[model samples]
Target chain A: MKCNAETIGLMHKYLDGDITTEEEQQLKYHLEDCEACQEHFRELKRTLTLIQSAERFEAPANFTANVMKNLPTEKKQVKYLRWFKMHPMLTAAAVFFILMFTGVFFTWEQDNQLVVSKQENLIIEGDTVIVPEGEVVEGDLLVKNGNLIINGTVDGNVTLVNGKLIDDDPLDNRGLMASVGEINGEFESVDQTFDWILYKLKGFAKKVFSFE
Target chain B: MEQIIREKIILVKKGDQSAYEDLVSFYQNKIYQHCYRMLGNAHEAEDIAQEAFIRAYVNIHSFDEKRKFSSWLYRIATNLSIDRLRKRKPDYFLDAEVKGTDGLDMYSQLQSEGASLVEEVENNELQRYIHTKISELPPKYRSIIILRYLEEFSLKEISEILDIPIGTVKTRIHRGREALRKRLRHV
Candidate 1:
């Protein structure tokens, strides 16, 4: 028997068990006649059988336990990412609050308009604010980009930024002189802006995270 | 068995450590045998097989539930074996026990079909010889031959495990068999 390419190919397919019945018949016919191809197929089978019947190694008894023990602990950042993936709504809400806070904070910082605390009892005239005489200012008063006239008793500290302090009598019983920040130029304004941003962010954090 | 594997997979995906332990425990011997054949060293086989399980657990989220878990696992073990083979220094396998087949008891290896004791001993020696030859083959042929013969994986499954086309798998199997045959015939 010639045992040409087709016979050899058929033999391989038959050995691998991938041939159809029709092709199987053709290979069976060929192997019956071809002595050389039969010897070749026998060696292949011998090799495969020796390999299949070879000795095997088993894992150590502690393999699974060791695997479980050696598993890398999930990093905090990965847990946060997975948590955020599970809760997109909360992630979006956090992102929204952050953007809004950033926008409002910077805009308020850049604004040159007068910003005063405890506006109820204070008298405003143009850029000057006067705490009326005998009026008790309840809490700390903050004046920015304005003139502050001290006439009444302020129970808390007075913080003045980008403003002037005018004492009516320049005498006793006035509000205690606290830290004063006078914005002289752009550098001073930037410094005041950072301080104001920090103050607002601190208060905002308290309000928001207090629930948490 | 399939139900147990599925249940363990679900539990493992849900971050249950014991479930993962059960899963690894189920496949450990098979995986260790695979690594041992690919690497031809017990210590490296144990290390690489354990590494494969740890990797599978760490990447559990990326694993699709629809595929065969064993195939995924064998892929990891195969790749780790390949990496280790690539990084191996010459003479590293000198310490590997090529005659390690003696570790198995002959009585336990006896087949139900009666065969002469002399023939059984010769066959055992031949199998051990072939095993050593297999470990010496290049990584590419060694892996495909092991998948085809020892593991009895179909060509499609081997293709999936090696991430190659079925045609490539068939060609490699053919050539791998030829290489082993030539060396075998010389002896």
Candidate 2:
């Protein structure tokens, strides 16, 4: 029996136990007659047996204990979720209050720099705001975190926060139509978001009933 | 015993965490060996085996009752080992074997039952040579070969554990065997 291509394949199938009975018979006959195929089969067997006989290692003795110790319990997170599920309304109220508190603190902290209105006509010389002489300011003028030196006529209200007014238009409003009608101190208006909300609400109530 | 294991799995699924100890104890050594065979490093094998058990415990609810648990755990460990191999740099391919293989002693701590088997090769020197040679195969062939021969899994079991088709598994085993045979012939 001559070893052909199919017989060569048969040798592999024979090793893996995939050959038919007829194929096995044919391969065995060829192996018996052919010395080359015989050596090939031996080498293949040796290779496989070498790997199989390699050592199986043992895990450390503390392996099981360590795994058990590190097993994170699903119960604690589940219980926390169950509690939230049980009191949905309370949870919602808590979330709402938390959002509101954080919103206020964030706005207060972020509004740290000086914010001056009517920036077009104002000359900022360091921390002092100079309304240059003879320039008539049109809207309500406000200064934050700095001093106001009003050298010009403010046609509307004047407000300053955290600093005194260095000077104002000398004309008095009680006797005539003075250009600076309102020079309010630090206690005048709200600047932060939370304060803005309160100021708007109080203004609404004052207009509805409390005003003269 | 199978029913007891299934019950323990069910308890774990129901959030009874302590019942998982029995499952871990039963499969620890086998999982460690599977990882060791795939990775070729004992320390990584131990760590990955522990990770496999932890992942199984975490995902107990998703495990199907109809499927065998050991196959599932093997799949997890095999995937983890492959990931570890893929993350390795190209330079460490041969360097790791040189540095890390010194502590490996095949004969020192064998189980009594496995020590005297007829399949145990007689030459310890040849065993060490083939052990290093096995690491030279790519992860794909290395893995299928390990599952097929070292662990003695059926072709279908290898398919399930690797999530590949059975025909693919068969082809890879042949190629892996051919590659190993050629490597051994060179020496």
Candidate 3:
């Protein structure tokens, strides 16, 4: 290629030892007869040399000390987090135990529900028991559960072990009954004549026990 | 040496204050010089250099060990200097022509040390003139020129430091050289 201003600029790169050998040879051949380009190259080289040789400024002696002094304090929380990162399994195990204990504490009451099968003749042990309808229970009834549903007829005295007794007929007592736990919820009956008595009993129970 | 610096950086990341100080000491001069050239003011350069070290320390955990710490430090210093420069003079446009005696004023602001007395008097003016010309270039072009010529960073390293593509770095270097050459020809 013939010498031109752009070629001379490229020659500046050549002078800086930045160009490929082929490009360097091409520029050298072009500059062999190009006096103006050579002069421009010379001036560019001189300017680049001046820039390259400029002295670097040194930081003040206390720069590092000053920077350290001004640094924000190392956060204790971050140090703890770094420690946790280094022992991931330990962190995970701690988290797991915390969650496990919380789960057990929160669900302790709800997990106390008991289901009594119709075929069993034994006393069910739980906080709540469901006694299905159309069964005849002959023995003294004792419900230790927090809630009791007795649709069957009882031949002996009915006793609420730790909770309220719920019957369809509140006044048709074949025997007397007693409760040791708070009574909750309304009792609905099939017989309409006892409804007023049930209402009066429920109102009395509400006033007497503050049942919710 | 690089491995030692990397180990120190890891220590800094782990909250070793002494290690952080060592890292700052290693880079303070180089970063201060880079900021001084970019900002054209010694006081601002020192402030920016300190700020860069502080920022690097604060965000050291985010630094990837695979990259060069010097390049990362340079990037922080360059960004801080540019931000300060932009804030100091809201009306100063990098692409605007060098007007009035602002160029000479900037030349006067250039400071050098450790040069022999003979060389200082003779070459100081010429050196300041060239540095002033460089300072006249836009921050973007000025940075590429400084990284390429002064800091002697490779184009790839410049790309990584500035977070730009290598092609853009090459283009900026070319345009910066052309602008400098045009200004020098006038002188």
**Best model per DockQ:** 2
Highest lDDT against the true fold, candidate: 1
Query: What lDDT score goes with residue A150 in model 2?
Result: 67
For model 3, the superposed segments whose C-alpha errors exceed 4 Å read A1-9, A12-21, A75-212, B90-123, B185-187
lDDT of 3 by residue, A102-204 (tens): 6544544343444333444444435555444545555455443355666544445444433555553568564543231222332332222244335444645
TM-score of each: 0.56, 0.56, 0.56
True contacts kept of 2: 0.73
Q: Candidate 3, after superposition: displacement of residue A4 in Å?
A: 2.2
lDDT tens readout by residue for model 1, A70-164: 99764466467667978999999999889977886777768689888754788889989887776767667777888777666666667766677
* Residue-by-residue lDDT tens digits, candidate 1, B50-97: 999999999988888778899999999999999999887776443344
Ten contiguous residues with the weakest lDDT in model 1 chain A: A179-188
B89 Cα displacement, candidate 2 (Å): 2.4
Q: Native-contact recovery for every candidate?
A: 0.67, 0.73, 0.55
Give the alpha carbon lDDT tens digit for every residue of B1-187 in model 2.
8788899898788776667888888889889988887787776788889999999988888899788898899899999999988876767543234333475343432433246543555555566567667777888898888888877788889999999998888788888988899988755
For residues B94-182, write the lDDT of model 3, one tens digit per residue.
44443334454333333233234356667577677777788889999999889988999988899999999987887788777767777
Error of 3 at B72 (Å): 0.4
Assess each model's interface with DockQ, reporting 2 decimals per model. Answer: 0.35, 0.36, 0.33
Tell me the TM-score that candidate 3 gets on chain A alone.
0.31
